[model samples]
Target: MRVGLTGGIASGKSTVSAILRDLGAVVVDADLIAREVVERGTPGLAAVVEAFGDQVLTPEGDLDRAALGAVVFADPDARRRLESIVHPLVHQRGAELEAAAPAGALVVHDIPLLAEGDRAGSFDEVVVVDVPTEVQVERMVRDRGWTREEAEARIAAQAGREERLAIATRVLDNTGTPEELRRAVEELHAELAARP
Candidate 1:
């Protein structure tokens, strides 16, 4: 099964992903693929430098993600440009990983932006880790060391909660304890594995 797991920033999606990993799902992480595609010597990095200029790279020639983030997150056109360069490469690598998974393996694509509509139809099932926006902001501030305002901005930049939920095949509410979340995931795993 090809599953897409997504949630807002700091929505504990990683925790669910880890649990799924432990349960033997072959997890293909989009974020890691994205970084790999744009690493120092890749074509993706070269394209980024061309589009965004050398200012987006560090002295050692690695992509300075923070510099790029500041540029994209503040300008919609710039963000689209950056996506134009990176998304195709990310998707390509993700496909390679998915193709290599064992037959009948549960391959989960942990995509933070799966609900952004660009990746529609990319999965057999879509599982959203649902949490309130305020909770997301609080968790981002507490866990990621972002200020509340910064957290809010990041949240606003992504697909809204309702938008994500509307397309979900399953919604895992994470407002409660960690144990509760784990239980929900375990149940979900059983349900998914039972599908022919």
Candidate 2:
């Protein structure tokens, strides 16, 4: 089964992904691939440099994510330009990873922007780690040390909670404790594993 795992920022999506990984699912992480594709000598980085210029690069010539993020997040056109350059490469790499998994393996694609990109149809199952928007904001403030405004802006950038839930084949509500979330994931894993 190919599963798309997604949730809003600080919605415990990574925690669920990690649980799935530990439970023997082959995970293709999009965020990691995104970073790798833009690493110093790759064509992705070269493309980014050409699009946004060297100001987005660090003194050591690496992609300065924060600098680039500031530019793209603040401008809709710039965000699209950056996405146009990166999204294809991410999909290509993600496909390659999925194809390489063992036959009959449960392959999970952990993509933060799954809903935003309308990728639910590509997966056999879309598992959304659901949480309220206010809870997400609180988690970001407490866990990630972001201000309320910063957390809100980041949340606003992604698909809304209702939007994500709409695409979910299964919803794992993560509003409670870590133990509760873990138990829910284990049950989900068992359910998926039992599929024919």
Candidate 3:
């Protein structure tokens, strides 16, 4: 089964992904693949440099994510442009990883932007790691060191909670304790393993 897992920032998607990994699901992490595609000297890095200019690169010849993020996060056009370069490559890598799974393996694609990109339809099932907006904001502030405004902006940039939930085949509510979250993942993992 190819499942897409997603949630808003600070919504515990990472925790769920980790639990799924521990439970033997082959997790294809899009964020990791995105970083790999743009590593120094690659065509993806070249493309990014060409589009955003050499200023986006560090003196050590690596993509300066912070520099690039500052530009993209503030400009919708720039963000789309960056996504245009990264998303196709991320999808290609994800497909390769999915194809590599053992027969009947539970392959979970941990795609942070699945809903935002309208790519949920590609998965056999979609599991949304859900938290209330207030919980999300609080976590971001408390854990990620994000100021209230920054946390709000980051949340606003993604697909809204209702939109993500609307597309979910399963919802893993993360408003509870870590043990509760782990039990939920374990239950979901068993259910997924039973699939044909």
lDDT of 3: 0.94
> How does candidate 1 score on lDDT?
0.91
lDDT of 2: 0.94
Report the Cα RMSD per candidate: 1.0, 0.8, 0.8
The true-versus-predicted C-alpha distance at residue 160 of model 1, in Å, is 0.6
Worst 10 residues of 1 by lDDT: 114-123
Tens digits of per-residue lDDT, candidate 3, 1-196, equal: 8999999999999999999999999999999999999999899999999999999999999999989988988888999999999999999999999999998999999999999887899889999999999999999899989899988888888889998999899999998899999999999999998999
| TM-score comparison, 1 vs 2, better candidate | 2
List the candidate 3 regions with Cα displacement exceeding 4 Å: none
TM-score of each: 0.97, 0.98, 0.98
For candidate 1, the TM-score is 0.97
Candidate numbers, best lDDT first, in rank order:
2, 3, 1
lDDT string, candidate 2, 118-167, tens digits:
67998999999999999999999999899999899889888999999999
RMSD of 3: 0.8
TM-score of 2: 0.98
